[model samples]
Target: MQKQREVGNRVFVTGIGLISALGNNVAENHSSLAAGKDGITKAVHFESLYTETLPFGEVKLSNDELKALLHLENEFGYTRTCLLAVKAFEEAVNDSGLSAEELSSFDTALISASTVGGMCLTDQLYDDANMKFEGSEYLEAYGCAAHTMRLIEKYKINGFTDTINTACSSSANAIMMGARLIKAGRAKRVIVGGVDALAKYTVNGFNALKILSEFPCKPFDENRDGLNLGEAGAYLVLESEEVSVGKRKYAEIAGFGNSNDAHHPSAMSDDAVGAIISMKTAIESAGIDATKIDYINTHGTGTPNNDRVELFGISQIFEKVPPFSSTKSYTGHTLGASGAVEAIFSILSIQYSEIYPSLHIETNMEGFDAAPITEFQSDVSVNYVLSNSFGFGGNCTSLVIGRVN
Candidate 1:
């Protein structure tokens, strides 16, 4: 075991909120994970023409269903992306026991991330563009930052607010930024995470990349072809040690690292230099040895390139790699929301002392000696979980989440 580091001030994960294909909230998601049940399958809620051809990790609810659940007025302009974000954010705020006044305080900050934003309505956007008379209701909500901006205004959050667009690493950076704000005394509390709704735009984009799997993805498997796109929203409430007193703290933000390989726009280098640096930096920042990590939440997207390169990075970081798996097997690759969604899973691993499994490995990956945990593990006593998120343009990030004593 590695000696744990002593620190002056600590950031604590006080609350978590998540909605994915796996479940509607944290409890539901945990149940599904414990059963080793995968939520990925043929798309039911997504509206792509490839709906029957390509598998997806799609939320079961439709836009109208989500609106009904959220109880919005008929004429409300909330896009599907914003609706998903508000659902998770509301749950996180309620879980943290924050009142309306507390939410709007100047000391409270909000950091949310998303890539699809309002592009879920691509058809409507195109039609509106061609029409000269009336503009679409989604015109203002059609950017990468639209979801976060809507959330900010919805909750009347008055403190610092920002949006990130580093592809898959967006929400990990959001959580990291939230921790820094608290540590630097810039805010007493911060709500950070990400959301991405399945859209024709995103589906077609990934299809064009030739990385969309026809069947359920097999992450880290030799025959892994590509990834299944997923949609989800996840958020975590981080409070300084002083403010977190008497709260239901889940874990500590022990360490985080961000790096960009700058190697390619769509693929990582063979050695995964950015990924290796990210994990190493995170471990160093956590004041622990590389071997001390108990498990890893790998950024295994199941694509031929991603799985191999990520495994290479893991081999470089640990002489004997820890028991790790890609939860994306269950939720699929959630793009911008992956980091925050997987972070919640990491915190759950600590809280429950269990490690969830990576679904469907027909054969071991070639040239890789280590394999993902294929079955759910219980009573494992996980203390440290290193969650990795690497995105397009070689942007990589890792977060070290530790059990709170």
Candidate 2:
């Protein structure tokens, strides 16, 4: 049985911004997906020991190039992570046609998420902490909340603000919180999303776990071995219906659900308890039947554990699972930015009436009748999309985004 609750003021996604290995903005990423272009390759801009040995979804731009693109060439103390967030956030704010006064209004909120904040500059942080240098510009930019503070200060935002770091599910929770704030009448609008940049800290950490893929990740493949690390930043402008009237509404944030099974620190339980609850609760929260889900953007990390457990969870929730695929196959596992990155992909499905294929799948995983869509599909009646993001520590979140009508 599923639980139900009264629906409040509807939340609509009015604007979206994204920067990833695929491209620097929403249109570029969309074009890459439609053309079947793969962005995973050997790292060029990011410096790492695995740069030549392993594949990654590395953003093509360098830190200096990004700063120049954002017209912050004269600025200092901006890390790679902060630069990515600013690019996306600026795009989102501009896409929504928000005025400077509106951004600084009290009815607005900024809810961002990140797992690898300024920690991307781990070496600089260490040097600063040890006082090896007289004073590092990045001294105050080392926390998980550093990017959030940067945005708040840059935009002169004076409303509610928060930064979430719930592992891979960070941005999904950020989106959920933004919706809750609007529904509760605490804010009329919110900028919600996440950002993460490749760093030695994360690369070394995942490598230590022995889950770094040597080649491009193949989500839901029977012979899948591991996942590829990636870097990206994405944001969405969500507003209450009353506030978004006459605006270009991309999709309605119908419902969302979150759960923690606490089964493992980095892996889900064999039974997929947390994912099951998250999906079911999302469906119930949408006040729709499980069958109403037209598509699902799975948390398919292409790892041995995640692909299998996530499929099992889906099998339990829907009688006949809908068309599902993992966008991570294109962007690699983006960690914190994944949830919002894929959420925008889901919205594209609803808006364009198409489905993006999951690349590099040669053999389907056994024990499941459902297989991922391997080719670009169009002219489909896509109305509702379920975007799932399951993080380490069994933190699972699902968002149901649907057409406004």
Candidate 3:
């Protein structure tokens, strides 16, 4: 473990796990990002009739492949979502250097987030619900907490565990809750993040909403169309200051803020009230002026309403908006998993003093002077990065990750 400076009452990220279309771990994802590679492609792994009609950031592993990797080929209650979650969770646990004994201790806490959960097995759930005799093996795996519950049982984790589902902001809330728990001395260490797998239900729903782009997404662009649904699982191990000492620490959780637009269920306010409030509150709680923020990982979903509003919100706060970009362009929109995925990306930027680019934007968004970082920047000095995640029902969250050095 790498030695870290003391951070009293603060939360430190000690481990990171990521499985996306880019790669299966943090190093791979960082490599793809730094190389300006985009992972969006025609859906081949996801089983959907619209696979050819739309692009998706589908992880290149099939269900059987994932099960084989996790040594759970015969597991009955595990769905695609659970398999994804387990793969990422195991990686995070190993990265954190947590022994089996430590994981089962009462001082450890688990907080995971997901929008799809076990709904990835929609057909099985539907069939089981209609059956009168012996139910399907997926009966217990149909709930929103199914993945987390499975992880708890598989690892014999006896710590506090909870699942959150607040649309796209689910995982950001999980990270925030984990930090709060550690700050309050409720847990010595907390593993927090989210997982989401592509399903016909979500794909069809977004299609019906007309936010499913047929091509690769272009965030913060003049002709930005819509989002491309993606499937991924990401996790982060956050430890309290006491537990983080002499450990491999990535970045410090400096501050966080959450808000609701309250103007629309699926759209943010025209003025970006929720986003403005969340960014301001986060900057204030971090005790830093707006000028101190070095970079921003925006929740730029490539939608017209979201991009314009996000720009307006940031403009209201920063005299000069910091270097900012949306990684969703690389991974597509991973929905519930996006927050944690981008959080990991933000920490990577700070760790390497680098910034990833936003791809395929020919024209910048109108009425905004600032544009996304279009090229990779290396060997730059970075101190703080603010990552944002906004969800349906107006849920918005912002997290500040700062370099320890």
For each candidate, give its TM-score against the true structure.
0.97, 0.98, 0.97
What are the per-residue Cα lDDT tens digits for candidate 2 across 74-171? 98889999999999999899999999999999999999999999999978888888999798888888899999999999999999999999999999
Cα misplacement distance, residue 151 of candidate 1 (Å): 1.2
User: What are the runs in model 1 whose C-alpha is more than 4 Å off?
Assistant: 1-8
lDDT (CA) for every model shown? Answer: 0.90, 0.93, 0.90
Candidate number of the best lDDT: 2
Q: Give the range where candidate 1 is weakest over 10 consecutive residues by summed lDDT.
A: 1-10
Q: Candidate 3: list runs displaced more than 4 Å.
A: 1-8, 132-134
TM-score of 2: 0.98
Which of the numbered candidates is closest to the native, going by highest TM-score? 2
Q: Compared with the true structure, what per-residue lDDT tens digits does model 1 show for residues 1-405?
A: 564654546899988899999999999999999999988888887777999899888888888888888777574668888888988998888998988998899999999888787887888878877885488678888788888888888789999999988999999999988988888888999999999998899899999999999988989999999999999999999999988999999999999999999999999999899999998888988888887799999999999988899999999989999999999999989988999999999999999999998888989987878999998889997999999999999999999999988
Judging by TM-score, tell me the better candidate of 2 and 3. Answer: 2
Please give the distance, in angstroms, between residue 111's alpha carbon in candidate 1 and its true position after superposition: 0.8
Q: Clashing residue pairs, candidate 1?
A: none
Candidate no. 1 TM-score: 0.97
TM-score, candidate 3, is 0.97
Error of 2 at 360 (Å): 0.3
- Candidate 2: global Cα-lDDT? 0.93
**How many steric overlaps are in each model, in order?**
0, 0, 0
Native-to-model Cα distance after best TM-score fit, residue 13 in candidate 2, in Å: 0.4
